[model samples]
Target: MTGAEAEGVRLQKVLANAGVASRRVSEQLIVEGRVRVNGVVVTELGSRIDPENDLVDVDGTAVQLDQSKRYVMLNKPTGVVSSMKDDRGRPDLRRFTKDWDERLYNVGRLDAETSGLLVLTNDGGLAHVLAHPSFGVTKVYIAKVEGAVTPQTVQRLLRGVDLDDGSIAADKARLLSTSAEGGGSLIELTLHAGRNRIVRRMMAAVGHPVVELVRRQFGPLHLGTLPAGRARELTKVERGALLTLARQAAGDDTVVRDGGEDPHTDQEI
Candidate 1:
């Protein structure tokens, strides 16, 4: 292995993970040579230090890394904005998470018209890795459309459609159980893309605009039987599963089977 590849963590990354400051702020400290490792000045951005063994001090104070990483899952109900703060003072996801002692932000967003499993975390790198399209985290949703479904429509959706924003397609699509009571069909769709209102727009393009939408799953995490407007912390196993999935999706070969599958491939809701 290359010497650089075998080196310890970057000072900026460790500081950012420590929540001492943003990665950019840590980089500035390095550039200004305000950061030291074991009583020695290290100004290079690529400078590495082991958080456990190295005594790193920033601005004369020892930097303490954060020990616990917060992970939360919420069954977000409709009419709540997914943002951390809303200028309009409208109902938002904060209503459910305000009780938490830790500061948390939405891992991914669901619009006001949509609802269901939303993950919230303080780990910015984990959030970015999971939510970014390159990771291919499949999101599953159950949607109520305005009309009846046809086989041809399903084929077209799977093949993809040209939306105003860009051409998009579902990774998987299937009508779960049809319902005649609501005069609309309850269809399940799974897609890897997170475009604004992509599910609704995809259905609209196929002549069946969405009437209601709810995200049922994100990665291996499910909304499950959780009621709307409630939020809870993810268990240790779930958190580990997420980290494993992220590594697997990123092409990390160190991941084991661990008795569960990665949610990179979108499944029918």
Candidate 2:
């Protein structure tokens, strides 16, 4: 091996570790000649870099490695898009994070009509792992449906529902409670899939269209009493748990490229 290759890590791995993108996407950047090392354009796939000594740039902009990772939990409110920006002038998640200076992206997604736990972070690698279905990071949602949810309906949800996109089964499905006044039912279900609008579509397909939806949990984080439209940094314990989950998932080769968008919010409601 060459001296540089022997002493340094692969360029793509370095970029992935630094949160530029997933390893696969980082390789694409390298191949496209958008990545440079120490002021020199380096397009060789097997190129290595001494992260501590070599300068890395993407598209002529310096790639700054964040020593401290940021993880945030937000209780998203209804009618707010899960994205950073919206062209139609609708309210977006950025308003909730305006106080924070860090450039953060949503880890997963909650549609504008669904309100609940949403994670925001600059840690692309962790986000990629958490969003990928293979990681088995469970997302818990409490859905209020139009009709009464019964054990039979719950069983059907557990069995799986076929949507136009594909068939999806909930990891766990149970009736949490029922509302007599509104003639609705509260059903809680957990799933590892990140397909766009899968929860809403699944319930709708099962003959109980979701009237309201809220994500109560995402992996190790919970939406415990955080006011709607407010966001807070992840506690050290929460952050550690998430990092550990991501690391374990990555070690198992369960991570899939996230493409830097909220996996669950890719489809419009």
Candidate 3:
């Protein structure tokens, strides 16, 4: 085999590529002495091993890097927590995809009271990029407020809201035409920040408490025609589009090596 293909790779990256868990979890495994390199217990997080030359084991089983990447989009239904599991016995995101044995984690979070698009994947780099606020991925939400949104309220949201953490603002927002009618107004809001319940709290701070909220879009990814409680693997074009948008947000000039855009691109707006 070529030297490039036989070169040594890092332990944490191997675990990440194996789809066993995230890089964070792999590091934890190293710290907990659950990982071994060549039969020697390895607790060092920085340890490296050659995929073909080294015998790296986690819990006594060998792990090999997964060349095939998987990306899934779930229309997260309300009441499911954004976790693989919970000790409090509360509902978790795992209930939605019980058929898969491959380890996958949520790309970002949606509160128990909120619902809509959620990304699941084993790609650590992609997950980190999407979750990082510095990437400025615009998350679009349709918020149902207790009363009609006034111009003043819109101004407050656009300018910024003072939360306990500090000032927060949306990238953009405007009233939307929805079937809910006059009881409550539907406002579309965009934010790059992923603070805890940020969208709900921001509107609440302006005296326009949200009655219901649905995340309609995340960057170039959208809920589209996917019905609630259903999910599908992301198409190659969709995945590339999301990566391009995220890279652009991070000030990177990532030109598409290949593939076209998704037909559902406009759904994010």
Candidate 4:
């Protein structure tokens, strides 16, 4: 055995530790040519690698190997800024992250008035791809708007509308329901738009200004009934899905011009 292989971790053990499966199952997967390291297929059970430095994947999905890297899902509440600290004394995210020892930051912003899911993590590479508009990662949001949202409004959102910045469109948009007394409507939108206050702008263009907005999903991750202002560590399956999304995004060449690519900064509605 080479000195480096002896010093490194076994492939199956690495996969097992990464939560892919049991050691035996991981070995079987390797033998079946379902594992890869640095883009090269590996079927050798005895192969070892530096988990900290080498990238690994099983069946085209990425595996999180670094134990120190943390992925957190937070249900951000309205009236709190998407930052860890607020210079103007406004409420920030410090309270939610106080229990964590690691320095975590939001992967993308949700406006102070907009509440819902925000991915908090120390993994900058994954955050970069997730937050970048060019990756075309879809986000789901439910918005309460001022007027009655009709099928025409949904069609407008799907067909695209011109804004001050440029033209924009939602991958999917529908009127979920309407409030009988308040003359407000709930609309759900699936989009990859990252422009500042994009949802508000789009609704306003359709004559239904948004009154409240809550993002419910980001890529493969969902808010899933988590109460506002709470945070939790991601499950193994969630981590696998998230890492897989980021991996797929990294190789995409689609051009998306929406702004706010920096995950550390808050910029969307």
lDDT on C-alpha atoms for all candidate structures: 0.74, 0.78, 0.71, 0.84
- Candidate 1 structure lDDT: 0.74
Better of 2 and 4 by lDDT: 4
CA displacement after TM-score superposition, residue 211 of candidate 3 (Å):
1.1
The candidate with the higher TM-score, 3 or 4, is: 4
Better of 3 and 4 by lDDT: 4
Give lDDT tens digits, candidate 2, residues 12-104.
999898777899999999999999775578998889877755656677555643344577899999999888898999999888878677788
C-alpha root-mean-square deviation, each candidate = 12.4, 10.7, 13.8, 4.1
Q: By summed lDDT, which 10 consecutive residues of candidate 4 come out lowest?
A: 252-261
The residue ranges of model 1 lying beyond 4 angstroms of the native Cα positions read 1-66, 179-182, 251-269
Candidate 2: give the clashing pairs.
Answer: none
Q: After TM-score superposition, what is the CA distance of residue 222 in candidate 2 from its true location, in Å?
A: 0.8
Best by TM-score: 4
Q: Report the lDDT of model 4 for residue 15.
A: 89
lDDT of 4 at 176: 90
Tens digits of per-residue lDDT for model 4 on 85-169? Answer: 8899999988998888988889889989999999998877778778878878889999989967778879989999899999999
Off by over 4 Å in 2: 1-66, 179-182, 252-269
Worst 10 residues of 1 by lDDT: 259-268
Ranking by TM-score: 4, 2, 1, 3
Worst 10 residues of 2 by lDDT: 252-261
Per-residue error at 148 for model 2, in Å? 1.3
